[model samples]
Target: MTKHMDLPEIIPIFPLPGALLLPRARLPLHLFEPRYLAMLDDALKTPERLIGMVQPNRMPGRNGGTGLHTIGCVGRVTQFSETEDGRYMITLTGLSRFRVVEEVEGFSPYRRAKVSWTGFERDKGPSETDDGFSRDKFMNLLSRYFTAQELQTDWESLKEADDELLINSLSMLLGFEPEDKQALLEAPSLSTRRETLVTLIEYSMRGGDGEDIMQ
Candidate 1:
């Protein structure tokens, strides 16, 4: 496990919509854009191979660029391969969540930010558990949600997955809106995350128009 002090103060930020990476979860990405490819190359040279995965906010940034959310998770490049077409296929294992302090000025093609890891110290520790998790009820709700969305999954595998893996994996893999995914990523604990996940699924099933209920 990585210690809180071991994390870098500044990291290359990848502003992606609808992508969530919770602590201890893995996110696979295909990098075809030149800026992100450059970000990947720079990260690989660092010992930590860290990249900040932040979702872009709806507001326009300075110079009419995309603005990024203040919160983001740091992921370490764990697996990488070069495609024949000169693109990159990589998997990032999440390490911790951070709050953006400020953006650093640089000539690089991608954005960089100074981040703070204040309240998220728990992210560097072992996996968290949710004692109140109602597996059967959650499974039932998930089954209905999946059916409604016309998605398929391996039931046995999902049943076998531990609490953290199951919740975090679903939080990342589910087709929730970018704002909902951000809520899951910013959840204070495993139990809170689970509750938020259930609420989002329930809202979707009830035809709530995918509004941000966490407000």
Candidate 2:
């Protein structure tokens, strides 16, 4: 995929409430909805292969195309293929985070946003590792969380994973509510995200609802 010197002013967004894409992270999406299929078709034809992954303001409204959160990550369509069932399976490699400047007028079936990359300029840098992160604490909390949720995993693979992979992959895979996922996505730094994840895991283990962390 080609690197972007800067984010585009107008871009199409895929408003998936619980789905998020962080810089340098890869997000896999299955496009079945007609509107999104059209969006993917357009993206496939473009050289940039860009798509903004955003969350809707509400759950039920997501299917009806509601207002979106201001912050989102831009991803490039790195891998794509069409299924016999007419669905488009694509993997997006995240590029940068962008804040919506305004909505643009468009006739396309998909939504478009005028965005600014001023706030997330740091995304172009290298990925964060476990240098100063509390990896041990994080892992302990993760173990508790998995047991609490009754989720099974391959311990060997998980332990062998790097800091970035472990943090980002679990952040996306965990059963956090949309808002909680958004908090992680919009975190200012990797360290901040790690702290937030630890806090949420602790709350869940204490018989408190995980979603209540934001409240």
Candidate 3:
């Protein structure tokens, strides 16, 4: 992670099979499995419990899941509660992009990594966006898709959102396929990611199958 006196020493990361992290958005997750349970315990004992959320690239064998994509967003653990079975219900707020520097050989059921963050180092802001009717058309289609899914959202809030937050949030949470999510997440800038997301959203709105993520 980039070192700034303001940013925490360790930005928390939570790796999940299918979950995705959108910057500036908060995701609530449950920590139940043994390895993750241990991870949560470790975080609880630390000053800042930050986690990275990444999606699996293959099916896992031990946790009975699979491999994860290379990139993920670092999140901070801002809230926590307990379940009856000793699991954790925690809220993770997205912070920055983290690249797994290397894998650590471990005995735990889940994977862990030594990571490097690029938030302070890189300009995450989008240089420009696709203007004109394309953006408007995509928004119209996305609104319809949301309507069909029975999800309620505040359009005003979304419209007012910064470009980075809007693109990242939609890229993570929208109806795109796994690979598409990765594409959006890995886009070099907020503008490019939004353009890609809009394209994917349009395809989904038209009932098309986005490509598989692993390929």
Cα lDDT computed for each candidate against the true fold: 0.90, 0.81, 0.64
Clashing pairs in 2: none
lDDT of 2 by residue, 1-215 (tens): 34545557899998897997988889999999999998998988987889999888764534234478778899999998889999988999988988877777788999988888887877877777757776666677677778878999988887888888788888888878889989999888877887777776767677665453222
Query: What are the candidates' C-alpha RMSDs?
Result: 3.6, 4.0, 5.9
TM-score of each: 0.92, 0.88, 0.74
Most TM-score-accurate candidate = 1
- Model 3, 4-36: lDDT tens digits are 323443333455654667655678898888878
Error of 3 at 136 (Å): 4.5
TM-score, candidate 3, is 0.74
Stretches > 4 Å off in candidate 1: 1-5, 60-66, 209-215
Q: List residue ranges in candidate 3 displaced over 4 A.
A: 1-13, 59-66, 107-109, 118-120, 123-138, 148-150, 209-215
* lDDT of candidate 1 over 1-215, digit per residue (tens): 44544988999999999999988899999999999999999999988999999998886773235388888999999999999999999999999999988889989999999899999989999889999998998898889889988999999999999999999999999999999999999899999999999998889887878654332
Q: How accurate is candidate 3 locally (lDDT)?
A: 0.64
Order of models, best TM-score first: 1, 2, 3
Better of 2 and 3 by lDDT: 2
Better of 1 and 2 by lDDT: 1
Count residue pairs with overlapping backbones in model 3: 13
